[model samples]
Target: MVILLNCAHHLSQRLQTTFVNYGEATMYSLETCPSPWLRSHSVWGRYTVSFLLIITQLGFCSVYFMFMADNLQQIVEEVHVTSNTCQPRKFLVLTPILDIRIYMLTILPFLIMLVFIRNLKVLSVFSTMANITTLGSMILIFEYIIQDIPDPSNLPLMANWKTFLLFFGTAIFTFEGVGMVLPLKNQMKNPQHFPLVLYVGMSLVIFLYSCLGILGYMKFGSDTQASITLNLPNCWLYQSVKLMYSVGIFFTYALQFHVPAEIIIPFAVSQVSQPSSSPAWTWSSP
Candidate 1:
């Protein structure tokens, strides 16, 4: 009888232990299954993608600056010499289309593509970069206006075709990256505000460029280069201004190259300037 009792007691304890073990294992499996895969992929995949993007952006900007700087410098010197004495060269370039103005056309196609991007935050960062370039150009232009135009010039106006052309270029500068706006806008946390941001941002850009263009043109006149960098005055001032403008151009290219890189490889989207947590919006469900 005692033997039978002992056997029965042992069976009960064994059953209890098995139930507890199975319960704990089930909970552990559930908690770990979904998260481990996600964490691992994010840590490894995200960094890899971002690093590749940075490399490509730097390469593109470096190439552009290397090839274009000399012609631009010559144009600036000529404009400055002519503005004070000679009749400004007959609208130097034959067609307005020849310069960065062509980039304005890129805005439409960029918007169409932006609609399909899945990440909003990445778009915001890109938009911010474009905004900075435009804003920087405007600031350069404004400095020219403040310095060059004199006599009843406390208020600046769009006085001539040259003025109009300069302003048009300013618009081009800001809107040049229009292609990236839509995608970046779509990725924003509150996309409705995107247009507002665009208007406010671009208006500020216009003001800056208009001022700079007027100043640079008045100071250098018709001899100004396609870029504002050439119009810089000689002396210590020119060196500092040159460095500042050069930095702006470099930054513009960084964002510009990033746009294509982000499009080609979604992973690269994270490489654009931003905090570590920024989401990369590469794809969208059609």
Candidate 2:
């Protein structure tokens, strides 16, 4: 756990330094242009960042989708099958499709629509709500962890080499916000304070990730799910936690999508026709 925490901290600081150096070099372009530093880069640099952003955000979306689907499925199974025997065997309209698939299909349109909303002001409410939900979920998770502390004797100090890749991948996925650091710094009212903001924000994030990862592993041992939320007990409170965190993840998708969208959409538009006087052209003009 200590090693993981240290790794997270160092990785975050390294990302911050990279972003700061990049931003310092391209501050003027980032402030004036829609695509920011990406547009100013060589073809290879632009494509590399674009590919990483697209892949990372897509991975994040998949994680969120699975997180929502798995928890909701568990909650439904608990309520309908184990507790409320009187309820219908299946609650979904698409009986042929799996419940998780049904949920994903149902929510996908709204997520797609959200991607088109370019205005950050319009997304601020959802972002605020997401922050709240995330906080609530963390509190509930900590409560559960403390309530049932596990014996340390049985737990491994380090996972075997076979599982090391899983640990490494999970850590990378958790800290993949590096792609957004430049964009976020560009948006700040006082850009000079971005270092402080990054430091404080990432410190909190590292602390939370460490606590949840360690406590969750301690409690569940080897039986943990891909998401700690899915391992939560089948109760109303924890069910609410799942749903709330899902909402947070749902809202967060748009913000993550924004980075890649800005990078790719401009290039796509440039290929269609000569840049026009329209807002879309102006926003994404090469």
Candidate 3:
């Protein structure tokens, strides 16, 4: 991650073309970079990058759906405690829902409406609130876990290769914000400092995630639920954490949807009405 992050920054600096999207960055990095050896398959680079990003962004949105659903459903459903900690379920549930899938269904309409928002001001407001609530939720989660943690001495060193692959994949998804690197750099007044900002910000993110993962594992051991919020106490404060988390992820759905929208929507619109000129994307090249 560190190597690729710096590589992209330097590569962007060498390319004279301004990139507004990941596809543009990919195309230039392949076709027009200063080093000829680094450039190849320029024609297809934009398409490949767009396809991969579409899949990635869609997967992220789907995860957001499931994340909100899982956390909110735990808060809504009636508690059904199991004696087996290994199969722990239901900490604090308020209402009854037959299936977890139903919780995702309830979130669908709002998510659909969320992506249609083109106004920058509204998105800023929503993102700010989401950031605030997300921070609060993480604080609450940390507080909840630190109360009476168990011994980690008995914990296994590592899981099998399969679970390790799952960990690797999840970590990759966590860092998928790298897709916005070129656009972020492009918007900078002093783009040279952008790399510094990226490095510092991502370093902090890595540190925080490391702390959270270690603490969560130490706190729950083998019985950890899919979400740490679900393991929280069945109280008003903890329940609020669940709601805040859902709201945060809920608003985040729009940001994730934005990337694919820019790539796909224009082409779809162009197909509806034929213009003499080519579609707006323009091969993501200069």
Candidate 4:
């Protein structure tokens, strides 16, 4: 961005200088030059470009889920004493799909509307609620999974007190909404609405998670995979649900580092566009 900005600035200056040198001979102004043309061309292009991104992600997700489902029975058959739960691969992968579904269908669309949303305060409240609820869901899931380990097979993995502590401690990965919290916080227009959103979100999260966990526990008991896939006895439902979940997750996690990249890209490009600065490190936004 820095490089682009510098190039824009330099080109603007050069155009003005050229016009002055030409002295009334040139019909075109700097605004009509190639730099401005490019700027105009690309200014609203991100919105359109983002559409293609969603399509590509969805396609990849479909293929991935299909491949996984085809091998799922074989994968399940391979499980032995060492493999107590379906969560090692399936759950880890599926939860992200759930997260992505919430983000794209719910959060992302809502956020995009933030630009033109009339009810800034209300929307902020909603966003805060969403984040808090998301966090609550994470916490509840962690608690349930930790406590509801029905299979004695996993007990050895948590044999020692120190090891037990490590297992629960590392469970933070299940609740990893820290990456999203700050952005939600900053976007809130009414600070007072935050607490309300958090409370509501948490309550919803707890309720949904408890219900889901209970249903899950009841359905599979000892056979419970960390994810829905292993718990699903019906092959068709397993494939369908897994497909949907994987697609959603692929979108959300794939952009986990987007916030930091957003900050870095502009500056890198700006520096590159300058005469004395190093070349910019711009790449296609993934």
lDDT score at residue 275, model 1, on the 0-100 scale: 65
Off by over 4 Å in 4: 1-170, 189-191, 262-273, 276-286
Sorted on TM-score, best first, the list reads: 3, 2, 1, 4
> Candidate 3 on 26-100: residue-level lDDT in tens?
666677667666576674777888999889888887888888888767666634542323332344435555588
- After the best TM-score superposition of candidate 1, give how far the Cα of residue 38 lies from its true spot, in angstroms: 41
Clashes of each: 16, 0, 3, 15
lDDT (tens digit, per residue) of candidate 2 on 1-286: 2232233334446557423322233332333457655555544444554676677877876787777666666666566434322221232332333557887787878889988887665666778889999899889878887665778688988877998888888878876566566666545567557667767888999888888888888887887767776666655677778788888888887877777777678678777776467555644311
Please provide, for model 4 over 118-193, each residue's C-alpha lDDT reduced to its tens digit, 9 standing for 90 to 100: 3334444544554554454344444444544455443332234755765464354334443333334334455336
Question: Cα deviation in Å at residue 35, candidate 4?
Answer: 52
- For candidate 1, the 10 contiguous residues with the lowest summed lDDT are 17-26
> Could you say which candidate leads in TM-score?
3
lDDT of 1 by residue, 31-150 (tens): 445687644454444344345444544455444455235334433444443343222234333333235423324332543464344344554455466557545655654554456354
lDDT (Cα atoms) of all candidates against the true structure = 0.46, 0.66, 0.71, 0.41
**Model 3, stretches more than 4 Å misplaced?**
1-17, 32-40, 79-96, 119-122, 274-286
Candidate 1, lDDT over the whole model:
0.46
Cα shift from native, residue 215, model 4 (Å): 3.3
Better candidate number, 1 or 2, judged by lDDT: 2
TM per model? 0.41, 0.75, 0.79, 0.39
In model 1, the number of clashes is: 16
